[model samples]
Target: MPETALLPDSAAPAAGPEALDDTHYRQSFGALCEDQVVSATNAIYAENGTKLIEKGSRIDRELYARLVQHKLRDPIDQQIGIEGMVNHESLEAMAAALLDQATVPRLLAASLGRPAALLQPLRELPLPGPIALKLTLMRDRCPALLQHALATLLVAMFLADRANMPTPLRSHLAAAALLRDIGMLHMDPAWLAADRRLNAQERRHLHAHPITSVLLIRQQGGYAPEVAAAVFEHHERLDGSGYPRGLRAERISPMGRILLLAELVAALGHKFGEASPHRLGLVLRLNHRALPGALIAQLLPALQGDVLASKVQVEEASQRFAGVANAFEQWTELQQDMKPGEVRGEAFAWLNSRLAGLRQSLTEAGGPPEQPSFLLAHAAGDDLHVADALALGREALWQLGSICGHALQRWPALADAERDHAAGDAAVARWCAWTGAMLAGLPGSSVD
Candidate 1:
């Protein structure tokens, strides 16, 4: 538990001060661009480090068991992202293969102006990356996966700035909060995997990550000294339970609060039993918006994956020219585009025929006839195959202004591999950025 506050100033900024408009939004953007922080995944990885393991291989179960010692077990991280931390809903769905939620399709969506990037990952740029800059991650545990987790953590901070806050305050908070754990990547894997937990000697070393992040930024020679200051102050919490320095709320920067919230959320969100990832996400999303907790929380279970089968059914249908099974398959085999709008015309005709049949069937039964609401079940020798109908259905859903992932829930098991990824690694860094753009329906933007 954190130390109690002795002195108190209960006043805070008004919850609804007239928001800065779009024009003012530019002012905020302009201010951010001026800040000289090599702020991208590549930059972060170079500044810190990540663990790298061979591709397509599972982590050593023995190593993981040993690493998750008694003290460490305090943090139960289910549904983590590529990095160890939990984040705003589990994004494994966005990045996972099951829904084509990764970078490429999202970029395509951005180019098409399909949706808003709000609540998406790449809320900001100048974030860290996946490639090795100054160090390699392979020497540690799941380096690539862990880096993604860190990126997810950073993404959480970026979104947290959404609450009515000042531009400078938000930026300060983002930078400091993101790099708070930079030093952890350097500790020996054996130490990280230690079973007995950290002694006082180990705790001292653990406190150094924030400092390591500060020094790295300064050494890189760009960010404002003020920014660096916040990084150092992050461990200094409001209640005085923090390490390195026990500064209270007044002394702690907003960045400190943000990072503190993130750390707490991350720590608590990783637990097993009652504090589930889905439950954690709902609570965090609500709390962060309402009060902005001292600790951040982005739960994994509440993460809604690629829209849904029904929505995908519509999208595929909308994209396809035919009415059913393998209709698009032949198209894929051919390199050239079909003659003009032939596919669209054909698909529409098939739809009309089906609609007409439905209307007639309803009239025959002396009932009101509207559109046919059919589930995707295959019937042998059918005029339209289930696959074709499914595709057409997706298009129809899109026409109705409902994107694929409208009704989503959390998945608790997806992010187990997240911690193994490295923070500041290049590959996962770019992926984070790309994934953000896709989700938000924006373009010409990068997360890092």
Candidate 2:
């Protein structure tokens, strides 16, 4: 028996408000219809919250079947707007389209041991995972649906800013958001055995699903090229420690880099309800890891919004943070990639249009310029293992500033300090000589 699915008859923890954050497990087409009915009967909560299932009786397969059949409605074509072309027919088709995602259905089928139905239409006008979730929310619960839609859009804004994607690529957002967990849908019924324990096979199956999902998306061409790349690599690690393929930092796509922002927000959003301290760690790690700092920085605020989604009092609060995050994220990325010794003419002319009017000092008035301060810090500091570097750099800069007549008179002793400021301001002069020597690799005083 696996540890996750089951324990040796241990006492269960008390259950309280359960907010389902994992979209990895989705409904069977039948389950979808049932959920619609139960959600509809709840009526008020259903629309406001997104299609959420009530806490009781949902796990009962027989009850689910009855519920779906009761709620199922025939697609009735009618005008939804000025065109009078959007009606139940369109909505039903859309619903079916969402349900047909190969990732989820295959998992569900394998678990249920049932052959999939005629699901070809689902492949035609594919909606992204975020879009599909929104549609589900709308159909089953309107308010919840609105909340989800708003969050997805806001998350995307931050992601785009960081990824250098334009706003018009909303479809990319939809695809990435929607298709994120398609691979998990195909798990055996025993997999979710959410009761109390996990068997060995279930755990193995769980680890394998994320990789399987990437392949499933590939078959459908269901997502944008970058969107799919992100889905594939969202679980990958910066130190080449993550799964499916433990790809290094350089191989991951920009889209994959940014996709991690959304994944973190979504994954840990529910934990905030339980008041987990880990929420902050999850938020920080998604970007702090091998993901690109430029884009990930912009996403920080949006991820915060998702974390606070249930608790915030602000109206459409996501957009504001997203805008700020995106701007800085883009700025960071540009400086990182700018060539250290390239011509100002060709590089400047080629990338000028892509700059989006942000402030960057890529080249000096004469030609290629010195590196940006942040990159310089990384070059000088140890980056991931940067504690000593950070401390020493702080000390060095302070000493340098004093020498240049720019620093405060008194300075505190720092951890990385190898000597006291016993020499007072004259220490700055000594530090300058030391730094110059180190840069020239001449000897004498060491920097560490």
Candidate 3:
């Protein structure tokens, strides 16, 4: 069997706030100049006092090689300007278009008596000059990222209105959602590629984006401290599965929780297309422990209407579910054979707890894992039922993969003399093997 690439914990020390990498950003910005006007407002310099670009220089593809080699004294974003950058007027028009054309926004608007009120929070948001410049770069260079931000902002505002949050807090939530991913602009572009498998060092770089985002927001100077706090926690999961910091439950701020959920909703819609509402409902059902139940309850109402078919093959999905069930049984039997002391060790105990939670989630989403074939067979004739089964199976498989990843990452940290190292390694290897095989066969699976 081919070995699955398990993401082990990175031993590299955390990067300090001042060490933001802009190699990829500079390259992408220079590429942007090939089509549009981008120029330096102030002279660009390296850390050693060499001037890289003159104050009024027009940045183009020719300058990219020069800019990328140096460790810049100031971030390129603060020193450069793009023509027709995103401002309040352009952002409002974009939000208005999304409200008219997007299904999620339309559904959210239907819940409100005055759908136009949704755009108010976005309009009132304070987009300082630096923030507008970053947004413009994102729009021109990474259009999908900007769309995601706008989608998140719209959904977050809808939720905030439903909760009757004060206007100031609502605006802060909007800012948090809009700017949550600005840190990605500074990361290596290869690390963010959807099809690429990340090495541990690359994964570390990807995970530290939240910290980088917080620093950028602080540097921009107009956002509230809460906006930065929310941005920091946007990737966090309530059950402590999230990264950069594995904060759980109430340690995540109120606005942080809202942004996290909103981001998930936006990402799901982007990934699943017309069937996003259906897929999102199943994901929320299976991940109640990882997300806030109250937020889920509030969001569920918007997805209540009819959903388009997901186009997943029923027979193939059933077979995949059977494969997953067999893997789960194998892990359970392996656990039963372990010595009591080994089973009680911290590492094994943690893995067992997460697996147990997944088991419960599977049971709640469908029937027991053992009976997946039976349930799927019963629902074979109805497209919606079959789609639900397929979606549920996919989510369970993804969650299982996540458990294996966490096991690999946490094993070294949780290891101790009392733990059985050989047995633990073997168990994690087996789980990764099972997850990799299952994920390999499943279509559109993004667990890795």
lDDT of 3 by residue, 72-165 (tens): 9986667888789898889888988887777777778877757777788888889876788888878987888898899899888888887888
Over the stretch 301-345, how does candidate 2's per-residue lDDT look in tens digits? Answer: 432322221232121122222222333354345445555653334
Least accurate 10 contiguous residues by lDDT in model 2: 74-83
353 in model 1: Cα distance from truth in Å? 78
Query: What tens-digit string does per-residue lDDT give for candidate 1 at 1-448?
Result: 1212211213111112121112222222223223322122221111123332222223233333432332331111210113322232333332232112323222223333432332233234233322122212321333433433343344344345434455545554545444555445545434555234444445555665565555455444444455566666655545443555546666765545555555544443333112233333433432332224433432222232222222133333322222211222222223133344333333233323433333343333222222223332331233334333432332332211111111000111112335433321222222223332342342111110
TM-score of each: 0.35, 0.37, 0.86
User: In model 1, what is the error at residue 320, expressed in angstroms?
Assistant: 58
Candidate 1 Cα errors over 4 Å, as ranges? 1-124, 127-155, 166-174, 194-196, 273-448
Q: Rank candidates by TM-score, best first.
A: 3, 2, 1
Candidate 1 global CA lDDT score: 0.35
Q: What lDDT is reached at residue 227 by model 1?
A: 56
The number of the candidate with the highest TM-score is 3
What is the Cα-based lDDT of residue 282 in candidate 2?
A: 36
| Prediction RMSDs, each to the true structure | 24.2, 21.7, 6.5
User: Considering every candidate listed, which one attains the maximal lDDT?
Assistant: 3
